[model samples]
Target: MNGGVVTDERLQPDYEADDSSINNFEKSVSLKDLEGGAGQLPEQVHTHHGANGEATVYGDFEKDKEQDVEDLPTTTRVVTAQDWSSPDDPENPQNWSMLLRAYHTVPPALFGFTVTFGSSVYTPATHQITERFHVSSTAALLGLSLYVVGLAFGPVLAAPLSEIHGRNIVYKASLPIMMLFTLGAGFSQNFGSLLICRFFAGFFGSAVLAVGAGTNADLFPPRLRAIATSLFLLAPFAGPSLGPFVGGFAAQYKGWRWTQWCILFISIPVYLTCLPMRETYKKIILKRRAKRLGIAPPNGPAGLAAIKILAPYHFTISQVGLTFLAIGLGVAISTASAIITDRTLYQKRHRQALAEGRQHAAPEHRLYAAMMGSFGLPIGLFWFAWTADNGVHWAVPVIAAIPFAWGNLSLFISTALYLVDVYGSLNGASAVAANGILRYSFGAAFPLFTIQMYEKLGTGWATSLLGFISVLMLPIPWVLFRWGPQIRAESHYPTMIS
Candidate 1:
């Protein structure tokens, strides 16, 4: 036996290992200890895209050298990672037609739409809810604030699951649960029931927001991700903004309950539409391949173990904390400018910078508009606060919100893209999870005190308080933009690769 390994009658199929396999091996095995698969013998590792689009890597650790001759199988063929029976494997999502990928992507966006819309749809109905149950405003707002909190934590659990099991199952399982609780909220007889239902609804609905980004990564590689990411990112903010607008009108006309009912009506069709979505996680795709070839799946503990596989990815505390602070400032300031039309102005500036070759220049160049947003956010907030009096035309304050909202959205999208770019695709969901918790938690607490702050201090000073805080955090994006490379160079986080 060569190198203490027994020769088998069969041999591994010929297939070129894809790039992902090399990366997986590098992540899992130390360069000094190249023996594959968890302390087993030097083994053959096969890396390939799994059935559902997840990156799946498998290693055959049970070489015949370790066992008695009688214990070994008499006949076997080592299936290559790309053993798809043919080149254009119908089972491989990477090989799917673009039309099919679009079909898969739309459903997650719609799911994101419905859940995010639900987060604030009941916000305008707060007065009705308070009146119906004889509750105080703070108590009434639990319905909204708690949902925001759910949106924050849901990703902590859901993102890891998508990384493990694939995206479709999370959608299928979580959507129905979210729908059920939403319906319960609609029909609840008391404030307590409504509060409980809304919180759980947010909990379940959050799966789409948490997992959809990963699914997008699964469908579109880095070069093609920008448009899809824009659409996906817009849904979360757009839903909250639109929810209040629709719920305000609907609550005034059809009553508060109709707000919940309308969400259910829209959500049902979206749920049904997503049922046929093919699984997009590559690990799952490869696992299916193993099953077809009569090979055992990878040797590891399942469930939580699957998530632990991603633990090697690391980011600096500066990246997490600074991004969180920046996002919180943007969210708080954007609340004032929800309906502002001028939000696109800075985006136009950002686009101009890109046209001027900033895109090819450096990743930090993407933050030009974000830097502008820092100045504009405080301006918008102070303007909206000071001018938001009954004596003034409503349009004045509304106009003020434009710059603030524009700045907030621009900064947020840029920061998000920056994090995703630096962290790389495999770690994107986890990277987002770190910042999302802070942002959503802040978002939840901000509204609970918004009306109280406005009423107590008047709109001018109340908004000024928020604007002042925005000023404190204003230097974050700018500093990061100017010296980001230096910070990244010194930090433990992965550097951006072109």
Candidate 2:
């Protein structure tokens, strides 16, 4: 007996059974004996014995002995190297090496820079597009406005869908759609057709803008997320700034039609380069792997599928209301600033005259003076509204727009960084969803009222109304800065501090 147990009648050798040996043993074991053994012991006993006659059992079966341990199927979990770590899995995406993450990050940043530039590249082309399409200037401007409108709404679907399917699918799918629609916009024969195509282009292009932020959250840790987000923010704003520069020269030399074609040409190689990048959202990737292994469904009330929809809503209804409120006020202030600038300049001469006479102006005069002269939006809105149509140059109203755009971008940068800082790795799809809702809703509604506002009240008084709204909404950011900790404490979403 090589390594066997000596029983009353025979010695059962502890042979190292390969597949063939196990099969032979199964054939030799009688059904009646197997059934009888099952009641008394395991159907099969796997024993290992040392040369010194020490015996050990590898595992035990209970309740049914007829079934040999060798007959039972062993489940070999195909664990990835990353899954070997703890469930909190700092070694996961959150703890990925800096170099590995930068590889994922840089491409999206490039993609983002390109996409954002595309968004407003048409701004300088508005004059040319107007002439080409035989439409009013305002109608041609709608092409740009509609693109933003698409951006506003694209995230509702793209963000939710990306959560379900993974960021890669959304990114890859939307990029091509964006490229196609952008190309189509160049060929449109009429204003309606051009506006429709441009809108969808913006909508699909928004997938990159909305999803890139989430992708960054998927890669970087909490402390590093802010810097990543800031860099990301720089792309969109910087793109907008640079876009006009390119568009100005393009419109000056190449036709406006060439502008759309130029962007399309630039994006083609970028789309091809992104094809190899793997999905970064952990849940989607793991769930996909688990499916391939034929595992039973995971145990949890909030299953993976539900997370796609629930997570963003959880973040939005909870953390982002203040952010949206702040942004909305900022937008209102911006629109009003155009009107305020005109009004303030008209009052400038009156105020100077009053100063020379040494006459006391009312408390409201100082308040009005403070608002008119300051770089602040509330003042600009108050001034622009009243004086916009009072023989002021169109440049004055447009220049007043500078502060609103600057302030809106600044507030957006701060709020976005704050959200990323507080949310960390969990910020991916949820943050995208929240931001999509916040930005698009405002983007859509803001432009619709802007012209109507200036037309009704004259730029001066129209802006003053907007300034009042901003004043009323000013408490939102203050509250967030003060009570954000308490709000974070109460949130169910994974927060950085936790």
Candidate 3:
């Protein structure tokens, strides 16, 4: 037996483990359930100390005494999960220094940025694609739409996979494949091949869509998560906005195919940089800990923007990409505003919670940023709708995107932080997975109908329609803020919030 750790490798456990050395050695009946990587880990795997003090490995999941997997068979195989050498072990992610944590944190964010960048990066080339492929504009738009829809569906499986495999392996496995498909799209001779490649690229590339928040949870505690989360999230929020900008120039100067080529060039560096990241999931570490005594580890765990040009603007397609920068600029402003709000509002309440001897402030307290920024979407939409005309200077319409971008970032951060606060890491992956499905689904659907809406309803009315939709949905966070505790209690998620 390897280091007194028994193997159920190939679905058979070695009960030869010495009971004496395994003093109080433990686990549930699910050991064999992990045979083909199927089953949940028993609670109370193990924990030592937090960065500050005693920390339970899986948040507040109190362990329950249960039937040992060994007992289910014949002789019992006792295992001491020697996961960490000590409570304050540097290997434990929570104990990592700020620099070390940042090292692990950035790759996922960059990789995510690349994927979102890919989402709309090709949009600037829609005209080029239509001409080359002999397709209509709507069909050309499907390259973007299919990719987003692909992203929406991937979280169904990716989140659970991350929960099982840990975040690093998922990224490693998916990013290269994503890059490969992207390259495939670039080389495709036909529209069918190109669209298929785009969908798979987004599908394989979707790991970050669901796992990023869980990674954030793995590295930083709630108090410090806001700033790090804001920064990490900025890459994604900025991606779609910036994609057209980059793709426009690339397509204009080089060709439509260069849009995909540029993505491959960008993604290679991101993937290569991610190759060395350490695992952050505690269950996986604890599984290895049980493995040192012997065993397995635990289980796991978009976009748009691309509007076209008209007469007064006299903007080229590539310049159209530049105009989309207004949205990116909005994204940047929103991120800055989020960081400021975190310090002024969220952190202040955090300090207050600590003073009250509580571990977390209310999840609803996270809503202030969302509440404040909610106006951006509709306001920007209406502003763009009405002002993006031959009558007004193009800059006026462009300026409208700033508030819209701000509102998007604010709401996104608020939702993410709130969910992370409510669910912690393990379950947070699944929670965020559900969120990803809905989020990307919407991301996918928007581009498909947006142009149609712009055409049928007229840009003014169509854009105003979206604005009105945003206005209607604005009460959601307020309702959550008002009744979140009661809803949270009824839902029965193991929240970290007080």
| Weakest lDDT window of 10 consecutive positions for candidate 2 | 1-10
Give the clash count for each candidate: 16, 20, 14
TM-score of 3: 0.48
Give lDDT for model 1: 0.61
* TM-score per candidate: 0.49, 0.49, 0.48
**Model 2 TM-score (2 dp):** 0.49
Question: Could you give candidate 1's per-residue lDDT for residues 1-498 as a string of tens digits?
Answer: 122221221213234466654433322322122222234343555544444322333334343555554443333222333334334555666568999988888887788778878866776677788899997543555576556645654664566566567778999999899989999999999876886688678878888876676677777778987777667666665565567668878888998998899799889999999889989877677676555443455543233213222222222323322323433344444432321312354345447768987553355655665676788889988987777644565456556655775576556545554665566544543454455445644543343344446557865687799899999999988898778878778767676643
Question: Per-model C-alpha lDDT, please?
Answer: 0.61, 0.55, 0.66
Question: Candidate 2: lDDT of 91?
Answer: 30
- Residue-level lDDT tens digits of model 3 in 268-375: 888888877889987676666555433443322111122334335565536754665676577557656766777678778889999999987787887887898888
Worst 10 residues of 3 by lDDT: 53-62
Task: Please rank every candidate by lDDT, starting with the best.
Answer: 3, 1, 2
Cα deviation of 205 in candidate 2 (Å)? 0.5
What is the alpha-carbon lDDT for the whole of candidate 3?
0.66
- Index of the highest-lDDT prediction: 3
